[model samples]
Target: MRIAATLRMALRALRRNKMRSMLTALGIIIGVGAVIAMVGIGNGAKSQVEAQIASLGQNVVLVFAGNWSSGGVRSGWGGAGTMTVDDALAISREVPGVINVSPEVRDRQQIQANGLNWNTQILGEGPDYLDIREWPLQDGAMFTDQDVRGTTKVCIVGKTIVTQLFPNEGPVGKSLRIRDIPFKVLGVLSPKGLSVMGSDQDDVVIIPYTSEMKRVSKRTNLSSISVQSSSPEFSDIVQRGISDLLRQRHRLGANRDDDFTIRGQQEIADAATATTRIMTVLLGAIASVSLIVGGIGIMNIMLVSVTERTREIGIRMAVGAHGRDILLQFLIEAITLSSLGGVIGIVLGVGSAKLLSAIAGWPTLVSVTSVVLAFLFSAAVGVFFGFYPARKASNLDPIDALRYE
Candidate 1:
């Protein structure tokens, strides 16, 4: 009951100076709101990066055929087809951590269906290519191993091809002609949006590598190979295993450089995530500075409040009130101010996050963890800043206080 009375008196004091109370809490409100909004944006960016990574493939590693060299004059990477179909098979069969290996030969060729012609990337892909790339079918079935061995004139296409050629119908079981040679469309791949390189991922046609060698590229070697591990944790092991195996297969001496290049998706993800994490921490740190400023504002206002209430303190002490009661009353007032600001800030922050997403086309995720931390910090600010003034009010010389103006 005594505590309740103290709270009532504290609230009444705030009510008597509504404008002053609100002004005092403005800094806290802004601080909490800014912190929440910034963190939301940071998380959103991180999520976008993760989604892009998943879209590319999970636990994927790419190996490009070596650069061409003549008399120590070397061309850029992927300039020569040094990696072969046998190399991909060896990695898949002999490597410990490798789960899937999809060898590929690439060409940019014109495709025609019903005389609707479109130029797209033509890939000579292994049977496990779809599995390795995590490219699902929107319709029909993937070409089989039997198709690859037979060098069947069969193909799978992506959404961009479908949109370009089969506008009103499905491309499955249809004929898409490449290089004046007709091939049956085995499937339509799911929409994959854009690749990390900003190219449309769905703008492609896939055929068996044997068929590509026989009919399209007339090349005996693979252009590249993508390897996938069972899990991300094993990617490094798989990469190392691949490197050692390839070096041996190519019969490279210790002094000679590797002909092929291997790149891991996990490496890309780690770099991107690390950059974003640093930015998030930096932004959140900047936002936290406002919270410190808010604490200072609270301290300043509380000191003024103590000075204004000195006469009241004197009267309460004269009327049998204990020092603890005076301290509790002031402390309760500061806490109420900060906590109320926090609540209002939460609403403001969430609203701002949604608005940013809608207006700016930037992703924003307002996590519960961020919200909880903000609220707790506000409470701490209240307690830390409110303590000194409340203590001074409690320890006042009541007779001197009563005699003052």
Candidate 2:
């Protein structure tokens, strides 16, 4: 009965000062809202980064030409001095963990089909390139080994190339000219969206590696070689095996350093993930400061409230209310104010997350854990800030409080 009476008195006091009560609650509202928004944004960014990494393909390794520096500052691009077709073949024959290998030479040139012309990247690779990269054909077949060996004038186009050059007709058996050199279209790749590096995967043309090296670019050196591992677990082993083979094939002396780099898909994914996570944490920490400021505001307002309600406290005490009863009354009011704010903030946070995901076309996952954490933290702030003021009100001398003007 005493508890019920105290609660009734607390509610009545809040009702008497409607504007003050609302203003006090607003601090908690902003605090909880900020926390929810920050966490949601962080989670959304993480999901986007992971999705982009997954799109590259699983259990894949990319080996490029040029030397890399382990210490001091170096240029962004690094590779062996030269990677030849023979190097790719040797890796395939000698590397135990390598499942498949595809040597490639790339050049950006203007390609024309009929009267339509557009600039696109041209990649020269064997049939195994499509199989190893998991690139599916939309139409026609991939080039055969015979096509590469004979340097056949056959090409495979990406979905973007097909859409740009052959809008009305299928690309299969069509002839596209790359710098006045005509090549028969053997296949077209399905759309594979843009890579994390901002390069369009479906905006290029692919031809037999031999054809591009000998007939198109006429270069003797390979740009890069892509190798697929049998399993994700064997990726490291395959990477090291390829590195050792390249060192041996290149004939690097014992005291001399290697002039090549072997990179695994897992390493790229890890670096991307780590960078994204750090960015998210940094942003979230900055946003959390807003919550702290809001908490301080709550504490300031609650202190003013206790001073303003001193006479009320004296009246309740004179009417047989104990110090504990007064303490419970104020604490309950504080908790109610904070709890209401938490609910409103949760609704706002969820709505904002959904809106961002829809607008940006990125993935956002709002977990139950985030909602619970926000709510709990808001309540904790109320309790922490409300305690001092509540204690002061409870400790007030009834006679002195009542006599105050």
Candidate 3:
């Protein structure tokens, strides 16, 4: 009954100053709203980074040919003939963690199909290219090893190429002309949105490396080789093994510079994750300042409330109200004010996040965890800031409080 009476007194006091109560809660409202929105945006950015990393493929590493240097003139990496199909083959066989490897060369050509001409990237790759990149055909099957060994005039097309070259029908078994030479499309590659470099992933044609070397570019060395480890944890070990094998194969002494370069995609993923983590921390820190400011607002308004209700506090004490009763009353009032704000803030924050995504095309992920934290934080702010004011009211001398005008 005492607790019920205390609650009734709190509600009555709040009702007497409705406008002041709302204004006091406004600070908490803004703080909770800012926290939720900022965290949502941060989570969305992190998810985007993860998605882009996933697009690179699974447990992948890239090896490029050595840089060329000739008496005061030097060309950059992938500019030499140091990398070859034999190097890729050796790495796949010798490296303990290696699961797949494929050599590739690149060219550009006007590919004609269905009586239309479209200039696109031409990739010359071994049969293992599909396996190395974990790429599957959307329609037909991957080219056979025989197709690569025999340098057959068959190719696999990407989705963008399919859309451009064979819009009305399926790309399988269709003939695409590269450099005016006809080649049969064995399959269409499953769609991969974009490369890490922001280039269209599904805008190319892949043919046997032997075919490109023999019939097109006439290159004996590879432009690059792809290596895939059995697991992500084993990628570094596989990379080291490849480096050691290449060093031995290329006959480079310990004193000489490496004749090739090896890059792991894990490094890229780590960098992206680090960047998103920093952004999340920065945004959360900025929003936290509002919470502190709202706490101060609650304290200030509560102090003013204590001053205004001084005489009433004295009357209640004279009528046998205990100091704890008086303290509980003010504390409940403060908690009520902030709790109301927290509830409204949740609604506004979630709505704002959705609105931002819809109108600005920016991603925002509102999670239940963030919302619950915001609410709890608001309630905590009320207790912490309201305590001092409530204590002061409870301690006031009845004689002095009643003497005040």
Candidate 4:
């Protein structure tokens, strides 16, 4: 028989048992849908984490002012102010590929403005801090280098500060009191939603590090330093240069650990995204088990079909249908069922992802690659599980098959 006739016969056979065929395809449909939905959720989470990491700005590196270890005591970074203003200046002056640097100090204070008082984070940073962070001013201008040098009482405010402290008035050109000392608001920072640590990014005020050390916080040492490289390719070089310069300046010997820790943008991003990547793979693996179960269902159903049609197979073989033709007919039926299921499952999966995103407020991203892979895998499952039953039907002796009924 011709290939076309065999395919037609196979399809016709399936149509004769529409309820059974539909029930058999359900397993594949559920399997494909689950895989796509789980993978989409995973990819969405990874993308969100990467976006947050990118918000730290391009080619950025951080220098935290604390030691990782002190003779095996193992005190991690950010314990105390081990870095100085002079250290930040030396990095900007001496380090190659370093384009921008910001000495940092951190504190929390109840700031008052416009007869409204709110407790927010206070940051001591350089004039180049916004530039290094790639953060733009929503209103007015950034405090200049002169402000840092003069230890001026000028400040920048985040959106949350504006909302809390200067709700009815323009924050720029306004005065906000930090630690009972008033500072002129120079600019309003563009709103940043949240940090990777899930803290509000915009609930802060920024002032010159000089003013922070000399006036408000009254500390000589810095909390940390933020650095920006000239380009992405130069980030590693800049990081290395800063490490070496700081080590030499601090006079740490080869056997002794440094007093500061340095982290580049790529390293931070990798660390942040590692959890999401693992979740993606784990979800995908769990969902794949359903596809295996679906394939088994197809195998079991095909074996039953071959048994029920054993006499029919004998009649066909006796008439002149080749064994290969018999095999092709059964194989086509299985493929038709699985391929049809795959197509429907693709639709179901995409719909489920969108629905989840809309209703549950979850981030979901369905990639074309995933859809294509699911479809192809489903079709391959048909071939793999369909072959045995097809081969058994084709190999039956016509005389014995005819006598069995």
Candidate 5:
């Protein structure tokens, strides 16, 4: 009953200065809201990046052709033609846990079909390329292994190619010219949107690597190789096997550096998401400063309230109220202000996140964990900041407080 009465008195005192109480709580409200919104934005971006990484397919490993340096000059991955189709064949034949392999030859070319020409990426890939990428055909079927072996003039078109060159008609069973040589369109690939690098994924054509090497571009070396492991658990083993096999095939000694670069799906994902993770921490830290400021504001207001209510404290003490009771009353008031602000802040933060998503078209994810943490932190700030003022009010001499003008 005493605790209930003390809480009621605390609430009544707050009601007497509604504007001041609200102003004091405004800092906490903004702080919690900012933390929630910023974290949501960061998490959303991280999720998007992970989704993009996942689009590369599960248990996927990538081998880029070049990473050699000589005479103070360095060649980045895919910059040198150190990898060959024979190396790719060796990996497929010899590497354990390897389920699929595709030697890649990448280029950009202008192609014509139905009196329309569109410049698009020309990707020379193996028969298992679609399987390795987990990509599906929207129409017809992928070219067979026989097509790759025979260097057949057959290809699969991406969505952009279909839209640009085969508008008003299906592209399957149609012919498009690459470098004035006619190639049959065997399939239309399902849309894949943009890649992690923000490049349009569905803006290319895929053909047999042999056909690209023998007929067009005349490149003797493979650009890169895509490998898929039997399962995610076997990805690391597959990568190690591939690295060793490639090193042996290229005749690199123990002392010599690797000429090729190897990366697994998980590695790629971690690297891609690292920036967003840092950004999340940075944004949260910056927003937390406001909460501290709000705490200070609460402390200042409580101190002033204690001074203004000194005479009330003396009267209550003379009437048999204990020092602990006076302390509880002020502490409860501070906690009520902070807890109320926290609730409102949560609402404001969620609404703002949704509004930003709708208006700015940026993704936002407000997780339950962030909301709970913000509220708990706000309440903690109240206790931390409100203690000193309440303690001082309780410690004041009753006679002196009563004599104060």
Candidate 6:
């Protein structure tokens, strides 16, 4: 009976000051909403990054040139000119963990097809490039070993290049000119979206590495090499094997540093995941401050409520209501108010996240954990901040409260 009466009275009091109650709840609503939205966006970004990394395959390794010095001055951009075709072949022959190797030489050039032209990145690699990079052909066949050996004028175009250069016609068997050198299109690549670095992976043209080195780049050195290990679990073994092979081939005396760098997919994934996690935590912490401020707002309003209802408290005490009953009544009112705000905030937060995702084309993932956490924290804030005001109302003297005008 006491619980029922306390609830009835609390409801009546809340109804009597509807505007003030709503204003108090608004703070909590905004705070909880912000927290949920921020967390959802952060998780979505992390998942997107992981998905992009996974798309590159698991057992992949990249070998690139390390910094070199000429006359004691560092030479080449990104420490270029370390790894060579001979080094790649040596690693394939000597390294037990290496399954396949493809040396790459890259350049940016204008490509023209059917009178349409666009500038795109061109990569030259052997037939194993397709196997190592896992680039599946969309329409036509990949270049063969003979094509690479003879420096044949055959090319595979990426999806973006197909769209821009050969929009109206099929690219297969079509001839495209790369810097005025005509080549037969052998294949069109499947679409791969923009990478984390904002580069369009599908906006490229690929030809045999030997052809690019001799005819396009006119350079003997390679830019990098792609290596695939036999097993994903043995990435470290593969890396070490390649490093040792390169060291021996380069003939660096003991104590001299290596002239090449070997990187695996796992290392890139770990660094990216760690960075994303830190960003998510930081965003969550910043949003949580809003909840704290909302709690303070609830406390302030509860104090005002206690001051306004002092006479009512005195009457209840006179009529045989215990101090505990008064405390419970006010506490319940505060909890109900904050809890309702939390629910509304959750709805708003989810809607806002969906809207942003649709409009911006960004991914948004809402987890059950985030929702539960938001609700519980909002309710706890009510209890923590409501305690003082509830206690003050309960401890009031009946005589003094009654005498107050």
Which digits, one per residue and each the tens of the lDDT, describe model 2 over residues 78-192?
4444678899999899888778889988899999997999999999987788778787888889999999999999999999998899999998998999888999998888888
Write the residue-wise lDDT of candidate 5 on 181-251 in tens digits. 89999999999998988999999999999999998899899989999999999998998998999888888
Order by TM-score, highest first: 4, 5, 1, 3, 6, 2
Off by over 4 Å in 3: 1-12, 66-74, 255-259, 315-329
lDDT of 1 by residue, 363-389 (tens): 999999999999999988999889999
Residue 263, candidate 3: how far off, in angstroms?
3.4
Please report, in order, the local distance difference test score of every candidate based on alpha carbons. 0.88, 0.81, 0.87, 0.90, 0.91, 0.87
Candidate 3 lDDT, tens digit per residue, 182-285? 99999999998877557898999999998998888888899988888889899889889999999999998989778888889878888877877788778878
List candidate 5 stretches off by more than 4 Å: 1-6, 69-76, 318-323
User: What TM-score, over all chains together, does every model reach?
Assistant: 0.89, 0.83, 0.87, 0.94, 0.93, 0.84
Clashing residue pairs in all predictions, respectively, total: 0, 5, 0, 0, 0, 0
For model 4 the TM-score comes to: 0.94
Highest lDDT model number = 5
Which ranges in model 2 have alpha carbons more than 4 Å from their true place? 1-16, 68-79, 94-96, 273-279, 311-329, 356-367, 394-405
Roughly what TM-score does model 3 have, to 2 decimal places? 0.87
**Candidate 6: lDDT of 356?**
84
Q: Which ten residues in a row have the lowest lDDT in candidate 6?
A: 74-83
lDDT, candidate 3, residue 31?
85
Cα lDDT for residue 126, candidate 3? 82
**Which 10-residue window of candidate 4 scores lowest in summed lDDT?**
67-76
Q: Which is the better candidate, 1 or 4, if ranked by TM-score?
A: 4
Error of 2 at 351 (Å): 2.1
